[model samples]
Target: MSEYIKVAVDAMGGDYAPQEPVKGVVEALREKPELYVYLVGQEDVLKKELDKYTYPEERLEVVHASEIIETGEPPVHAIQKKKDSSLVKALRMVRSKEASAFVSCGSTGAVLVGGQVLVGKSKGVERAPLAPLIPTATGVSLLIDCGANVDARSSHLVQFARMGSIYMEYVMGVKNPKVGLVNIGAEEEKGNALVKETYPLLKECKDINFIGNVEARDIPKGVCDVVVCEAFVGNVILKLYEGVGATLISKVKAGMMSTLRSKIGALLVKPALKETLKSFDASEYGGAPLLGLKGLVVKAHGSSKANEIKNSLIQCITFSKEDICGKIQENMKQDNKGDN
Candidate 1:
């Protein structure tokens, strides 16, 4: 048998819990022969869910986790207390190098806290960032610091740009990905103090292709491959992006079904429209990755279904194969040496 990429999955972390997670794991194992999974969750629940699918038994194993961390609980307290929870166990697997990555649809706070505290950060990494790929008109653009480090400094934004660049270029197959600082205007003097400070630093960086300020409106037009911002601004952009996309899709469907003539037109356009809509679905791109960590940690949507979970697991394969953490570590080391 070929070498396998083992992934530790938090089977009880999402809204669908063991059912969707189990189904997704089984689907991934069936689809990728060289994959191994440690499905961490309540054993009985996982086993019952596993009974519904047919997958290679050798490739999938059940690891027991007795507790669960709820979304409402404080992250630091939960991570310290829920040592036997599925999320924590999966993180431990990555930390110990037993698994190439950890995937969760659990509490965002707990995932972020546990990832940094347990899995630790790569050497010379200042702050870990949650970066997710957002759908754009031309393709997907990577949004870095989407939910981590809300009070990030200028240096952190620079690192986010560089790391986002590496991810887009290597993992997403975009060559010489253009990096842009999120701002209100096209001119360099337009954004707030943070952007003002970070802009010149990004321009000075020789490693990444730094583009000028990118307005929020221009993001959907694929003006840049990597979008860099502090978490506060990035989160607002992401949520607004999602809300607008959903509203537009809903309005389009409603308009199509409003009248008899439109219904006929909808029938003719449904296939192509569905394909286009599917490409824009955030779930199609998997989960946000907490980059600059010692091990890979993917935070899937809490409402993730079988398809999103499967994509999340599959994305880990590319991340591990490309040795993203190693590359990030080397890059950070180089940056630290330059500073010294």
Candidate 2:
């Protein structure tokens, strides 16, 4: 392929716009000499931002795009209409095999829609899932279908489990990662029709380590490496996880500053507490990937800053190096052979 793991970044995407995305690219270039980033956006704006940072000029190139895809626009229409937009231009690079992956903090809907239309799906993948790693008590777990495929089928959930397993195993360095279907109870018949059907399918698959049902309550306790569900359920769990983590962190800080005794205590434990809390930060894990596509397409937070963007770009290195898309396709081929 390319000499470097070229990442076509949507410089105009995200709440922070050209500034944060530009800074993140410069920051990423400083960290990795192997990474070649094509910052796709308005040339003049990107150039101005680049001037503020000192990084290797050769590694960071800019592709001029005339337009920007606003978050509020309808995804399908935007992708079709905004051909010269930053988001579409960056995706086209991936489609053309000029870039290894595409990273965007822009419209999630646009990314999801364009990724499938532009990058296309693997041979046997029916539906792509948005898989994001969420922090847990012990570590982090992959929450598949977080925002894509809300009405996913049993077979789709089964594939999600398998993809999630591969991602956890190879990229995250977890071996035979445990896969759990999100359910109300541990019983086989606890969930709706889809989960019940998928439960048996997952159990029959010898490829993944199928770890029965995982209750929502136990999710934060590091219940499993991969949690599988329809997009609706998965999204709820993810939102709740984010909300609770944020609330708890706020409450903890407020409590520490409430009174003289706690204030004194906060100072003594500040270093250790900060270290612990930082581990749970979602940004530390990078962006959520839309798996099952032919090429890697990651969707960073809409409000992403430099660190998040940098991490998202950095995350693609592992995906490309490990050949995650290839592995998923191979696994599906092997599974299909067994079925036949």
Candidate 3:
């Protein structure tokens, strides 16, 4: 709402924090002079890092704190006891209208729990999802309820579909994106009670382009623009997607190195292979955004480096500039009216 976009970076949240993420923030500012940021973490440590670079005095701030929350700490306990910790202090700024967005690489569980409790939720929303994206052949796809609500319901899937569709269209520039419910089979009647109930609702929905079921195999095939599933299933799929991509790529390289003839061919084809495989590299796409929160919240990968952190910061820049939260609120209001 203010003239300048503001973001709170969790300087100590990720696996390589106060250094790697901090470095990323500095790089992001270099590219976008319009954006402002508040680096939240231990006073002495944060300042020491900031001293390594020179940024605009008014455009950046360092919010000093004394405590650091480990990703392993339980969310409820960490948030309560470590009130002065970087994560809590950062979220409080958003709650108090001091910052427009919050970014953390700390704990996924802590963000989901603390975001809902402190940042609050949009009206009429029952649950919020950690919505990250996966690169598809067409471009990218938004996968909702990724790890937030693993045990979701029929109605919850409906909301995920609705939200995912809106996100792809508004943020990712996909028009009339198709929504698919993850299932074991394409048959209308082939699913658990919740999936069975959700199928009909998606089929009847007029607000989105509701395609039918998408098996896990069809995901990388780019079958749908948006893949919808409960968090448990979605989380498993995400982990496997990353793991398999890494393993397969590693195997291909190892195979090429086994013989001299193959090594020559690998050199001949190395450039094309790298370009082709770049799409599957997760860091290129940046961190996942936790949707349905009142403010923008992004979860950079736990081991994010400077580039990843910078990309995540750039994501927040575009998100606020596009008014993603407001657009989502508008779309949800329309969905609610139709339900009524």
TM-score of each: 0.96, 0.96, 0.95
Question: How would the candidate models be sorted by lDDT, starting from the highest?
Answer: 2, 1, 3
Best by lDDT: 2
In model 2, which runs have C-alpha deviations exceeding 4 angstroms? 336-340
Q: Which lDDT tens digits does candidate 1 get at residues 23-124? A: 888988988887899999999988988888778999998999999988878999999999999999999999999998999998999999999999999988
Judged by TM-score relative to the true structure, which candidate is superior, 1 or 3?
1
Query: lDDT for each of the candidates?
Result: 0.90, 0.91, 0.83
The residue pairs found clashing in candidate 2 are none
Candidate 3's residue-wise lDDT over 102-133, tens digit each?
88888887877778888877765667888888
Worst 10 residues of 2 by lDDT: 331-340
lDDT of predicted model 1: 0.90
Structure candidate 3, residue pairs in collision: 150-232
Question: Ten-residue segment with the worst summed lDDT in candidate 3?
Answer: 331-340
